[model samples]
Target: MYEQKTKETDQSVMEFIEDIENIKKREDAYKLVDIFTETTGYPAKMWGPSIIGFGAYHYKYASGHEGDAPLVGFSPRKAKISLYFATGETERDKLLQDLGKHTSGKGCVYINKVADINVEVLKQLIDQSVTFLKETYPSE
Candidate 1:
């Protein structure tokens, strides 16, 4: 049996953002709060300790691993802000191509700050991720 580490918490998203040691990172986190909230039409929730997540979906794999996860989220980390989005969407790669100066992992886009990317493209990425997840894993 396996337990997931990143479950949603009753913790405060604002407190977490305010606790960010770097002023710029904290400010960027606030900006992201607005963007994600506006894009998803869902209020932000604290996921685990650091991730500010918007809208959630439940998922179960073929192997029976199952959990609820945010449709989109972001963490203002020490090194760079991590933007979480769906990894396998067909339009993801094309959108990332125009997302400005950022590097991406399999499931996260790393940006030094919000100013480094085109906000419109970022919104498009958020929209695509949410749409993909909803269609792929509709609520029960």
Candidate 2:
């Protein structure tokens, strides 16, 4: 069973993307949704309330920690877009080399706007993240 609750609204994803209070951020998220879906072949789903999640996977760690996380997800935060890749940093090297204008947090990638970075490289990063998760967590 899923614990996170997505809000109930008739608003379509496009509408929600356009209706974000921050115009620049809204546009960036929309563009990302489009590119992410196209690049990964996983359509965007509004996870929990705000995260734009792509695909999905199941995970269990050596410490017996386990759960299901979206294969690749991002949230358009007020300050920046938070890209979620449950995979840790060591596996994220070469892509990081090409990722521009972004900051990394533990397992999260924070970028100001897709416009400020190389969109193609960003797609590759996301794809790589998804692939890493799938390979690491093959049970899903």
Best by TM-score: 1
Runs with alpha carbons beyond 4 Å of true place in candidate 1: none
List candidate 2 stretches off by more than 4 Å. 1-12, 89-91
Candidate 2 global CA lDDT score: 0.76
In the range 61-140, model 1's lDDT, one tens digit per residue, is 99999999999999999999999999879999999999999998999999999998999999999999999999999998
Report lDDT (CA) for all predictions.
0.94, 0.76
Range of the 10 consecutive residues with the lowest summed lDDT in candidate 1: 1-10
Q: TM-scores, in order shown?
A: 0.98, 0.82
- In angstroms, the error of model 2 at 75 is 0.6
Q: Report clashes for each candidate as comma-separated counts.
A: 0, 0
Report the CA-based lDDT of candidate 1 relative to the real structure.
0.94
